[model samples]
Target: MLRPGPVEQTATATAVSVGHLHQVFRDAYGCGPARAFELIRLARAALALQRNHLSLAEVAAEFGFSSPYHLSRRFAATYRTPPGAFRRTQPAADAMWPVRQAGLLPLAHLLP
Candidate 1:
């Protein structure tokens, strides 16, 4: 519903020219680049939780979050749980791929 300001757009567009930024920008959606990147970092944090044991501050720095408190606040808003608690309740791996087989299968061969 909100648009990115000039500065945020420039930064995000710059990231788009890079590699993984494409996926991050595409997957992370919010009112602006900063918001989207925050969302991207959140998703990455969620992914990171799959293997790593780190505090909110650690995750925040790794993902460019402004601060641990900032990460905690937004993460609660997004996930409805604290990071540590959320990690404890994680579901099984097979549950992650999606119910649709389409999403589970790699489609790179059909892309070109």
Candidate 2:
């Protein structure tokens, strides 16, 4: 038996019927499935950047990004700042949750 990953299954299902699947994802998430997935990935990446000492390359690899540059570009586009800047601005020992910057939340439409 072969099992497909989330991405594989999404791709396969979309290939079969893109309009229906796209609408379904949009209705559920207020965005297309691919965009929703991207938001989720970037959110996790931001969390990892704050909590881990991993290099951008390592984080990209761990998150299945093709390369550090790809990750940086996407991260910058989503967060409105590069990952290095986000990481550099972290407090010495943050007891509170990381503050969210603009352009980072795709589901903000669901919020107010």
Candidate 3:
């Protein structure tokens, strides 16, 4: 997970103390800023994997990984499968009818 370096400018721009900002982030995200950033990046990667025809290397580069190997290592650690294998096992669109239909439900009901 990438840790943002030196967010002093961000703190100043927001006019919030860094410690207070971190506390708010922790309260809202249930994790520190770095982990939240990692989850956001992984979500982007997941979306790309599901919707794009890009290769794993391309996906890694697209999502700001240092290299394909780095992305593979971290993705596997996080998801318990290599990205290639995960992509290969995704259900076809037609098979996702129930889940797609669930979009009609209220967003609050969809969340755990």
Candidate 4:
């Protein structure tokens, strides 16, 4: 069988639709690609909120969301709080994640 490249990976995220490729994503992350997308997006959002300089809209844009309002809606739905408020008031431990500086050592590791 031929191996798929990056675009195909995003296009067909479910194993039901893409065969073994979906399995690959699931195997690596222990979740379906769809779920993996949400998981990673939320994780990255948490890290971004820690900066406090960027608004939820900006964070959404930085993360490739379609729009600020869209980001606020989804982010709030998944996280159960508005992005702006969350940025203002998340617990330190939850806010801290492995951040990569110079592309080494994720900041998440620094958390207690």
Could you tell me the TM-score of candidate 4? 0.59
Candidate 2 per-residue lDDT over residues 1-112, each given as its tens digit: 1111365476675585666777876676567666665565666667788888999988887766778898899888866679888888843423111223323244433422
- lDDT of candidate 3 vs native? 0.61
TM-score of each model, paired residue for residue: 0.54, 0.66, 0.67, 0.59
Give me the runs in candidate 3 sitting further than 4 Å from their true place: 1-6, 92-112
lDDT of 1 by residue, 4-111 (tens): 235545557665433354454445431333444344456556666656787777887776667888777877777677777667787333212221222312321221
Best of the two (1, 4) by lDDT: 4
State each model's CA lDDT, in order: 0.53, 0.63, 0.61, 0.57
- The better-scoring model by TM-score among 1 and 4 is 4
Residue pairs with backbone atoms closer than 3 Å in model 1 (clashes): none
Worst 10 residues of 4 by lDDT: 96-105
Candidate 2 has an lDDT of 0.63
Could you give the candidate ranking by lDDT, starting with the highest? Answer: 2, 3, 4, 1
Poorest 10 consecutive residues of model 3 by lDDT? 103-112
Q: Which candidate do you rate higher for lDDT, 2 or 4?
A: 2
Q: What ranking of all candidate models by TM-score puts the best one first?
A: 3, 2, 4, 1
Those runs of model 4 whose alpha carbons end farther than 4 Å from true positions after fitting are 1-17, 27-30, 91-93, 96-112
- Error in Å for residue 16 of model 4: 12
- Candidate 1: RMSD to truth: 9.0
Indicate the residue-level lDDT of 75 in model 3. Answer: 72
User: Which numbered prediction scores highest in TM-score against the true structure?
Assistant: 3
List, residue by residue over 3-96, the lDDT tens digit for candidate 4. Answer: 1135356555433346565686566655555554544555577777876587666777776677878777877776777777777777463532
